[model samples]
Target: MQDFYIFAKNFHINKAIIRRDGYIYQSLIAFFMTGTGNSYTVARWCAQVAETTGIGSQLVQIKAGEKRGAVPSRSLAVFTYPTHGFTAPWLIMKYIWCLPNGRNLHAIVLPTRAGIRIKGAFFPGLEGTAGYLIAFLLWLRGYHVQGVMGVDMPSNWTALHWGLSKQNAAVIIEMAQSKVKGMLQTVLAGNKHYDGMVQLLVGIALAKVSLMYLIMAQFILAKLFFASDKCNGCSLCQSICPKKALKMVGRQGRPYWTFSCDSCMACMNYCPQKAIEVSPFIITLFYYIATVPVFAYAMSYAAGGDALQWGISLGLGFGIQYGYTLAAIALAYGLLHVALGSRIIRAIAAKLSHTHYFRRYQASNVSLKDIHLHK
Candidate 1:
């Protein structure tokens, strides 16, 4: 993937319109949807490079309920987001969908995937639909796509595993700094550089998985979160949530994740108490509950026959099962949240969550002030 970081030597800056787009783009606008600040760092790098080239730049964090604003003349909008479940996050999708016709701007897209340096080697994550999905949406909105590239930032999904060591994370982030600047320079020079075609194809092949994740997996993951015994009830997680999906509920004021949570890791990584956790026991329970075939059994009993062998209305059964899964998870999460207020239950729940043992991550340089996660 070393070569993925560089462009062809023959590539030269087009002083004129960046391509057939036929516009002198004077400003660089970067819009980033970030959780742990990986995408935020990428946006800053692009903006810095553009600034040095005498192009004024603006950085905007994509948040829910953000109103549409006027588009500037001869401007290029760069979108940087982390890849979630091999595709774009719902926040970004809705942002683009709500965008007014984009005849006024050109666009470039960069999706930062989970990347890390281990034993002096760099491994990149699969981006899937994270890149083209957004580009396609931009194109449909009438923005000329200048380019699309996947950036390798330090792996920030700490809930599933440990975070990269500072030494290893710095290596990956340092490489990304140079790579993102190159991508921005190439696009600004009126040359098109579409990277990650192979990853895109592979992601397309897993479209069903991505779709299921977007609709079901993500929603379920949202409910798996809980504030542990270590929580001092600071409510920092509630204030930092970009979607405002986290609520401090009951007498304890413990943070409770709602369905609106995008599982963006903002709450998990930024908790000073290190108390936010994904309950493995609950997740496992959810997995078994979802596969219990309760819907099939109900239908079988209602019809006085074996519905399983009959392949009875698989589509309808799936829909019913999906609802059941979500409903069950939500109800279970509520009970668990309340239960955790107890010392014994909280201790047991804390032990069951792998995240309690895993190291947390956020970009080294970013602060709550930087991304407005605090505001």
Candidate 2:
């Protein structure tokens, strides 16, 4: 199942994007750390592999919830991230929609998720839909296109928590070599069915339900918990609030979420306030744990009776995957925070904001660690 297209593209590509969930801090560490299974790190490694094979390339970050400009020509735009509820982060949807065309633009979508094969199908679906839709839009707008590609990264946090003793850092390097090689082969072979397979996966009712949950989680629950007390009155949140839903109040302790909250969670995750409270990391952990059983129940609901055999099998398979995925992320968080300094988070927030969305708020005096953890 090796793809030759990926190989051909890898050897001659020029530009690419290295995406991450919720923040760039983790991504930067992943890039530097080598094995953490982070999307950015994995994608960068992939790019380098592609380079050695003859592709000249550049990698950039696509933050959790913002949009970026067109991928430069002859360049491969690589979108990477940890899957949230089986899909890319909510904000990444906009990025997919905005993908530029007309110049034989190629796409490489890398989704990092918990280590389950069932869940592995999720990101390909998201990437396919976004890519197909963009291609269609571009076609209408008069841009000739080549196509899109996708790869999966191990769920580092979940894997570590589940007792998967193998750190994702090493896997990062391995996946970069093997996965990129496979992708290159696929691309060169002109195998377009991957997109169709993505369509089939997404067409299912269960998949739709899963996607809806992700949307609500990002656009709803994520906002409330993200606004806790750790925010440092720094207006950085207000500055990058893509929806302009944040504003500084009387120069107090931190920027406050306004009525325009879209639940993007950028403020909560990136706020230097140390003022925001609540752990999105913890919340997501619980979410994966709880939903494992629910996916079981949902199948029962759809079948009019418990598909006990299917449920049992999937439960075991997906369960193991989730366990491993969660563990890896947790370990990554602990190791990077303690060893590398959570400053990666601040750096990511700053780098993420460096784009058009956060350009106005660039001059802030806030330090990445200036915000304290909530008591």
Candidate 3:
């Protein structure tokens, strides 16, 4: 999390790579952001390759609101983060936005995605805009882009589906490590490599989905979290939220999600009591409320004549309706939080929530302290 780490032995660079331009790559620095630790693990593996190659290396976790000073001259910088929607997450985007100008500093982009294994078949995650978009931004910031690639790890979206078994996850992670090693080796050799061209092309076709994810879907997802009946008010999720998006509320100090949340999945996975849950009941309600608008009925009396004149659509007004949907869900969640105060109500809600019966996931190697220390 801090800006200082030397993975190389004794701070020594046993072999400094000399480029054709006469610049020597003596060290590496990887800035990574992770939720449930997949991206962080990929960054660590890249650093491990640096360590094995006798190159000095450092790791800096790309935390929300943490200041990045400047890029060191002669050091190769690597930017890695988990893919959200079809691209980079909000935390990754904000972190990159705040970095100082790269000034021709060499850099690479590695975006991790939700790799999965089902019935002994492995399916790779799609990077879509996750790789090149970040690279394009870095290039605009004066970075000499060395490579852009996608790495697949186990999916940690336990909110939507079941978590992978250990054997399945192990297979995916092992393949990812191999790719990471290869990508770093290419850069160290003074060559350029790029990957995910197919995913990028496919991602371009789905650009609208990515836009919706960034602008609206993520915000809506934030409202779906709640404390289950199993909660003990440990306050651990609140303490480790990267955006500080979780606040301890009420007499019991239970975690509450705020608008600042980007749906990073940190608070849900790392809760010691597994008290956090995503409400299926609320999701169903939200879908119906959002899709089947009440605005039409409320304004229906004048709508038959005024709709043709004033241009009222089925959504009433697309932008206004969307905004109202977000607001309505927020209000409903606020009431749900208040209702959860009663033990009987909380238990009933928990029984209806699918997340209550689902297994929670984090990277096997990742611990809550490891995440907290990263911040």
Cα RMSD (Å) per model?
7.0, 15.9, 4.0
- Tens-digit lDDT track of model 1 for 1-375: 111111122223333344444558667778898888999999999878877776667787888876555456577888999999999999999888777678747789999999977799888888998999999999998888989999989888887888888899999988899998988888877788899999999999999999999999999888888888898889989888888898898787888889999888988999998988877788888888777786785455346445663455555566777888888888888877777779678777888888888889989999988975544
Per-structure clash totals for the candidates: 1, 56, 0
Select the stronger candidate by lDDT from 2 and 3: 3
lDDT of 3 by residue, 1-375 (tens): 446323333346678878776778878888888778888888888889888877788777777666665766778889888888998887777667667778898999999998999988989888899999998888877899999989999998888887788889998998999989998888888889998899999999988999999988888888888888788888878778878788889998877888778787888888878878887788988787677665555455445566464464544566566778888878887888898888788788878888888877788787766655544
> What's the lDDT for all of these models?
0.82, 0.41, 0.81
Provide the TM-score for each candidate, comma-separated.
0.90, 0.45, 0.90
For candidate 3, what is the lDDT? Answer: 0.81
Collision count of model 3: 0
Q: What is the alpha-carbon lDDT of model 2 when measured against the actual structure? A: 0.41
lDDT score for residue 255 of model 3: 76
Candidate 2 on 17-38: residue-level lDDT in tens?
2322211101111111111224
